[model samples]
Target: MDPASHPEQLSVVNEQVLNSADRSVTAAVCLRRFLCYGSESSTYSTKECPLGIENALSLMQLIEGGRGSEVVDEVRRFNLEGRAVRPNPGLFTLAVCSQHADCKTRQAALRALKELCRSPVQLFTFVQYKKELKEGSGMWGRALRRVVTDWYNGQDGISLAQAVTKCKHRAGWSHQDLLRLSHMKPANDNIALVCKYITKGWKGVEEAYAEKDKSEDLQKVFAYLEAVEKAKHSTDEQELIHLIEEQRLGKEQLLTNHLKSKEVWKALLKEMPVAVLLKHLGKLTANKVLIPGSPDIAAVCGRIQDETVLKKAKTQPFNILAASENYKRGHGKRSKLKWEPDRDLVQALDCAFCKSISTVEATGKRFLVAVDISSSLSSLCRGSSISTVAVAAAVCMIIAQTEPNAQIVVFSEGNLLPCTVSSDMTLMQVAGLLIQTPGGSTDCSLPITWASENEKTVDVFIILTNNQTNGRENPADTLKMYRQKSSVFSKLIVCGLIANNLSIADPEDCGMLDICGFDSQAVDVIHNFALDIF
Candidate 1:
């Protein structure tokens, strides 16, 4: 279909098509710099291959066909030849790229990242700044970090998941190696050529490439190349020609429009079990911290599992500098209830009132117990999942083993089931209680107030939350409610599950014992902080 023949949306359609340099777009920009600077230095960060040079020229031609002047700001922003040594490069990178003109910033940023590709010291610095990279970032940062971090660490510049898909089995690459391959690189050496140079040297791709299943795709492609090389010794000319053709066709398929292998996508989706693509898409993106280009993009990305469609999106290239899906998870008042997220729950139980390791042999007499309604925690109901339900139940069971005489209460939508905890029965039989109801409004103070007033036997009142309130809008009023209850009672631990970025205006904020990420090893974090109540 000729783009010119379209009556409407020609411009829009063109925007969807990645610039003609294909998958090697990022490498191309780095190589073109050679023409201007006339040198490829590993230390200075401007190392471009011949193929890279060719791809960059093609990208330049596309931008020039529109408005060349728009790209000037892009060159200024992403230090195309400069270094991002700061704590949060993603934040600065996105700010510079988004407003600097579309494709212009994309290529320039790619070049800037490539320059730092070959240095081990630079890679270590990235790991040091890991928190800053994730804290306020979007999906773009994840994408770039996945690739760049691997390269700096001397890995193959791709993600682990990608590696699995490419090789069809785990190869020798570590997590860092996969991350390195996920992005492009600029160094010109083979052993340390970075992604840009490697892609160019191997595939004649001048531009950078981002495959949906980058890890797996690259490994599969590379393995074929290796096999063909070895086959030259034994395979005849006719056989060699057949092998070459197969390799060429395989390479085309590897680099072309197919996205993640269907098998891999299904495996990921299977983790959700009962959740459909519609529901789990948002869940996975939220957990992975990926944000689609627009709300529409988020919506589409969340719903579609189509490899071709996802591949196009892969080419669109997520800017890890955008707003993350996790920014709002427990943003102030939502997860502030009386229950822990999965990891936190595990931590609270794993440490037996000690800041050390706790296995099944964790000493006698459990000192802590956490309980919530089946509807409140179960995935079979609303706003929760089966996994979380299992997590909350696990907390109670851990207590039952250690304490033997621990008291546990399991609540459903309305009925509350109280059980005596003993080593014989660990997991609660609350699976039968999952049910729908008029969603009950929760109070930050109610559960704690009740526990403080009633459980005089408890050594420490432990509460877990996502740092949000259901109806308690006023933070002070809620705190006052707990304070009044606590005035008579002394022992209490207020733990918050910071599912997202929970900004505490005061470092010594009232009642903040600890803040845990969603995946923060629950038992480990509890023990690490020495806050476990025996």
Candidate 2:
């Protein structure tokens, strides 16, 4: 029987053979099957393709079982003959570094890595792995040093220096490795300069080279280094002064640049003059730019000293939905910045939403904030480490704060559980509480059904979800029924945290609005819809 034709049957057969026959023979058969069918399976684009890095890991596991010496020899031959490596270089690097790999396997893995390092991108990976996995290990370090030396010898000095710098800064190369490479025979003056700048303090470059002989080459290098230092200091001081001056002038460009900086934008926000701060607070709030390191935005909101600014802040068409989508796509991960908006700032932002409601005073309206805490919501938002649930919680907190009569509910499957949200609770705290709530199949109708069954009169139903709704009853049908029975005009706003084509709103219903993401503008949308003003 051909095992290659049926992988499932092969798995079962392999499992039975392992239990009934010699372990080494069973392993060898498994290895051969993996090499043939496994390699082909890895090329398949389908999600069900079983052969992957895990398969390579499993093969290594078998080799480590003390009976697969032949398999080890086969792998070494694969490396020696330039045959297709079972796993790609990145996965192979991770696999071979495991403690489970025998000495023979490690040697073969290193050889394969050496070949892979011929590509500049792969060389960067080698440097990263050296720092992450095998730091200070003599064997791995020597291997990498040799590969780098060979690469440097073949490449132009300037290109090689740029590649080294890129690897050092972006790939997390250690100073020690960079220093060693700087001293290699093929190393150019540019490479040495970059290495020195990274490894030594900028101010102490002269001190580091104080003892070197006063050759013409050395003198020229010293002059260039000093000039570079002067230029950097001059640029920094000028930029700082220019930014301060721009803030004083109440220039919009300063706010634009600040927002574009992402996490570091907080620095600009904090340092801006008070006049600039007050002038741009509305723009900042409307854009939903979370000012880092300061609660100034909140302070401005609490003071409400300028009613016009408050009005603008409340009504600005800020897209929280887009921001939430960007967060999910992992935009904030590289910045390593946590989303820790000040409590007052959060309250103030929520208040802006509250103020947007024209029919009733924000403090007097009855709000039902339903957040989907389904299992999928726990996953990180794009470009951000912050979970989708966390963003939803923040939105919920904002909606709840507008009215003292607000009720927050977390729904999953057919369950609707009330959430205890205090005004003092941080977004993180709200998120933590929501995460603790039990999750099941998504039922967007649960919250609506609960409110209708209990005779609850909700002015607005704010549902925060990824729109992957699977429920016994359609949410749109349930919402329609609730609106018909209610004496008060109710609005349904679906805030999608995930970017998908599917929407839960009825296209024909004017009362039902679909907003993508947890944007601050959602409150305005809700407020406008409730009053029939839009």
Candidate 3:
């Protein structure tokens, strides 16, 4: 394979090799992006959207190659331990991986079924995916039966009641349908009664309660289920409020019309989790419960300010950013609902994002943060109102604020635009400035070329972009040229702002990394990568 011996043939062979390597890198990047953010569509948003799951699964299989089992194991552990935001992607990936991986990995992946299927909807999705692959009613294997049985019987009576009540049906499969298919005999009287409710509704559960000699635990479960049934049918707000307070029912158990009641919202605010509160701030405001000087607003702000609650909920910074942006806009992203956003509530959301950032010690290395402001990045991120350019700006600011010795520059095709990023500049201010900056075609190599020409001694160069580079000089080769000129072994991190498969980092270089743009742990990850801590 010593191509140098034949100079004429070496040119073609080298080009072919480069093309093959680029294809492999693109596949790997696509697989990673699909796992993190579902779908191969270019719509990159900050919301937890579950779009094109089946399509994403097919793409993963085509690109996964030999690493299917490893990726599945990692995703399973992360989702099972509640480290990931939305568990549906992980669950779907595990199902797909089990079908394609080796026998042992298949067993290991399937063992996580009960833990991963926390809700009835998730269980239905999982079952649907598994069944779709094999077209037969007789495809229910022993392992499938065991897992389904364990999923129903493993939860405590109260948790099971909440699960059945909150999600009656999903993915064209009902709890009754699943119960019938599994033929699962209940392990306890309480579980048995919940199953009865799932199969025959409140009538069946009440019938059992009237006839059976049940335990106090079963009686309590019966009471909770009865409250859920009443809450579903009741039009009286006061009675609904009483039931919510007494039984600790979530907003899901209530009827849709009752959600408009300000008193009901006030009651729900008392115990709403930080995640749910952020998601529904618009609805709360539209109902006038979050008006100025309202106690409901105070309660919500207090919860948002609680760092403990934020951490426990594992709320991502992007979620807060999207909430603030959408709330300030005073309209739903995909709904007709409109409201006047409360100034105090918006401030609290912004502050919550700042406080929620994970603190990490700076590596004290010289850094160059290059952000791409191309026109392609102007699209609104998939599930949020914020633009991809703004998301990039917010992420860049996070890094610039953390590291003391960092300089930022904006780049397009032939320009290295002026960047006024400062430690004191608010994220929104920086975003507005960057978005206003005139953009041209994307050129990812501008950072490296600029650093070399300016004689900047940078230990790390971070490029935030949509990965659509059109420069003549390859960024990888430019990095090598920069290393030769400055005699500094600079590392490159390509943080993709949108869900594109292209990457600028060299796959062969150990000093380069390709990561998602708005990863909640972006700052810590970048710092560690710079310090060689990974």
> Residue 123 deviation, candidate 1, in Å?
4.5
Regions of model 1 farther than 4 Å from truth: 1-199, 203-367, 374-391, 398-407, 410-418, 421-428, 432-460, 463-534
Model 2 per-residue lDDT tens digits across residues 265-367: 4445544443345334434543456453446554555544334544554333123223323333432434444443345554544444334332223535678
Question: Cα lDDT of all candidates, in order?
Answer: 0.33, 0.51, 0.71
Per-model TM values vs. the true structure: 0.32, 0.40, 0.78
lDDT (tens digit, per residue) of candidate 1 on 273-354: 2213332333333343233343433333333433343343321111110011112232213443221123321222222112
Name the candidate that leads on TM-score. 3
RMSD of each: 22.2, 18.5, 7.8
Question: How high a TM-score does candidate 3 get?
Answer: 0.78
- Model 3 misses residue 347 by how many Å? 1.7
Give the TM-score comparing model 1 with the true structure, all chains together: 0.32
- List candidate 3 stretches off by more than 4 Å: 1-72, 80-89, 96-103, 211-213, 359-367, 373-379, 402-406, 412-424, 432-441, 453-461, 465-467, 479-534
CA lDDT, candidate 3, residue 315: 77
Clashing pairs in 3: 44-382, 45-381, 45-382
